[model samples]
Target: MSYDKTIAQAARTELERRRSQAQETARLNLEGFLSRCPRAVEIRRELSSNASEAARAVVSGGEVRMELEQRKARGLALREEYDRLLKSQGLTRRDIEPQYTCPKCRDTGFVEGRMCDCHRALRRSIAYRQLSTGLPLESCTFESFSLDYYRDDPAAMKQMGIIFRTCREYAENFRPNSANLLFWGATGLGKTHLSLAIANAAIEKGFGVVYGSAQKYASAFEKERFSREAGEGTAGDLKNCDLLILDDLGTEFPSAYSNAGIYDVVNDRLMSGRPTIISTNLALDGLEKRYSERFASRIVGGYAMLGFKGRDVRVQKLNR
Candidate 1:
């Protein structure tokens, strides 16, 4: 499934820019080396001329084998002499050669016209950014999460403590399609914080993680009804991402269309063995009522529901 076109384009453009940068640096280095070692430069020209002459002899049905052997010996001698000169000047052959970031692909972001792993990794990061465009990511990491806010309530404090540790662990070990999570609780319980923390982890691991509130996603999906390219069909992006975190599931402007859309997404991801983290204020029965039993049933069977039990920490923070 395709993500937002702009994001994909940005990733491609960035990778291309990196590749171009590598190529330019290599070219400049080669030019400098050739200028520094005129003898090595002459050797390269002779090697090229020998290759051309050998090709002509082969096509003309002459004894190309003897010519190829002589050229190979002459080229090896040139290479050895060049190396000796470099060593005498406190340099090495490596210093004079074009240095590539990925020698297999020559920093071209591809090999044999197929996408390189580095390019795919770039796309994954861009995909994550596309989904979390509006998220306050830096502010919601494990470090930023404050247990001081819930200190007044012993139960809340304990729950928050455990939640923090769990989230930290989750983030530390997160992999692609690792585990499904359900963040079920009332509002103001830091569901979004933990969700973003997980996203931070997945991003660190080079996995494409899509994170957004259900309200925002629902609106984007609806807007796509009018414009096909409205925000990368956020649903498709969610469906295909390495990890999906949908926050405030029941808080979206509920409608038949939205409900069906949510069900379709949740079900499809589950069927494909993709990991999705759904944070909802609604309880289990509420989920059953809002969507069909099928959606809830899928969650029951597939997801690891993490029940968040804590009073409103935001209120405690304000009072303190």
Candidate 2:
């Protein structure tokens, strides 16, 4: 999957930083160890010289095998002595070596000409972080959501309880091709909160998630529409993300282009069998009136509706 240049650059820079830090840390550790144990330093020097001698013997071609075998024996003895010195100080060989976060790539972000898993993960995380910017992802978890705000009406309480449990289960069992969801309710009814919770879970499970308010994405689509350049848009990210969370679906400024763009995104994701969660203040009737019968009907048929019923939680909090 392709990410924006900024995201990719940031990931690469971070990986390089990790690699340098590991090397610097190892160098410092070795310096400290040498300062404490001078004899170990001498043994290390002897081992280095033995390796150089072995190399020279290989090229000199005078009883090469015997000379190489002698050098190897001396090198092995020097190594044993070095190990003994380290053992006396309660240290091991690896203690003075660079300990990278990923041994496979040594924090280089690639191995054998292929991008490392760690590198891909870093890019995905950076992209998700950028896409989810300004949203309270850390605080919008299922555990932090309160049921106390829905206590005003019995029907509302019962409906909210079911919605909470169902949302939690959906997040827990989320997969790439999981069922699409429509969160229909009024403002502050926990629709956005639950959708963000699902995004957090999917990200933790290593799925690439793109989350944004409808207004934000609509503005992106509008901006990208006029800019007729290759690789110059956010729509690709919206369509290709493993999971998409479109919050406040009916809130964006309406236009022919924006509406069609939104419809295209929804339809493309649906056609590709990718899971999407759409939280909206619009009910079925409101959705049909705003978009089209086809758009509304596609949602109605494909998405499992989770009706949110409760007093405005934000207002409740403010009152308290």
Candidate 3:
């Protein structure tokens, strides 16, 4: 459940921002309250002094019982006066206090030296948001995916219905070590939509998901290869994310380095038992020819193949 350092840092920044906002708001509230009710200032000062006098009486170690009782009564009277002033001004103690987003952590993202649930949720949200950039995650949901596109052909419709159900179930039951999936078919057959739907579900369940076109990853891989640094970079994230959705797999600019990079990513994820969903327009044979028999074989042996059917869905939409 490790997160990217950048994402962790962003979450920390967000928590600090919330904390600062709460404190600043409380400061302004107190300033305004004191301005409106000037008497509250003297009451607050006396309340502070009364508490200090009680502490001093305790430490004096003499027969200070009478003095302590007197201080306690005075403190109570001061508090009552303060409350009356607040009531007159239509304010409460909370109105002058910091209203932290997470009262448990006081917006600090931690409690008693352990990370808080709110912090973990923030990190997951930030990770999902960063990974889902450039994706139509909001629109490509299972609810929005229509089976009507395949209605013209009963066989296509039936198969697509099953595919849709399977995809929905897969997403609902998705885990970090769930089985791999390969979506193979012609363009505009809803492969990308279903894969993104799975990604959205996984993200909602607090799993880190990395999703992008193959070309986007390929270009990143190529760029990282030529860089001076010798770190995993994009390959690490692709292989290590809780779920990886590689879309349009055969559309990348093919080169020796990019091809090998792609193979390494696919192979490494497979070897590590990490779940991946790859959507490709290439057929099994085309995949073998484009990459290598080894790459295609890895997919064949380790992945559940879902063949998308129907005419181009984009064309169908345009016609309708």
Instruction: Give the winner by TM-score.
Output: 3
lDDT of 2 by residue, 14-72 (tens): 99899999999888878888999999888888888889988998888889999989998
Q: Global lDDT of each model?
A: 0.78, 0.88, 0.90
Clashes of 3: 0
Question: Worst ten-residue run, lDDT, model 1?
Answer: 1-10
Q: What is the lDDT of residue 152 in candidate 1?
A: 69
In candidate 3, the residue pairs with backbone N, CA or C atoms under 3 Å apart (3 or more residues apart, or in different chains) clash, namely none
In model 2, what lDDT does residue 179 have?
95
Judging by TM-score, tell me the better candidate of 1 and 2: 2
Q: For residues 242-311, could you state the per-residue lDDT of candidate 1 as single tens digits? A: 7888889988998777777788888889888888999998888989898878788888988888777767
Q: List the residue pairs that clash in candidate 2.
A: none
lDDT, candidate 2, at 130: 72
Arrange candidates by TM-score, descending: 3, 2, 1
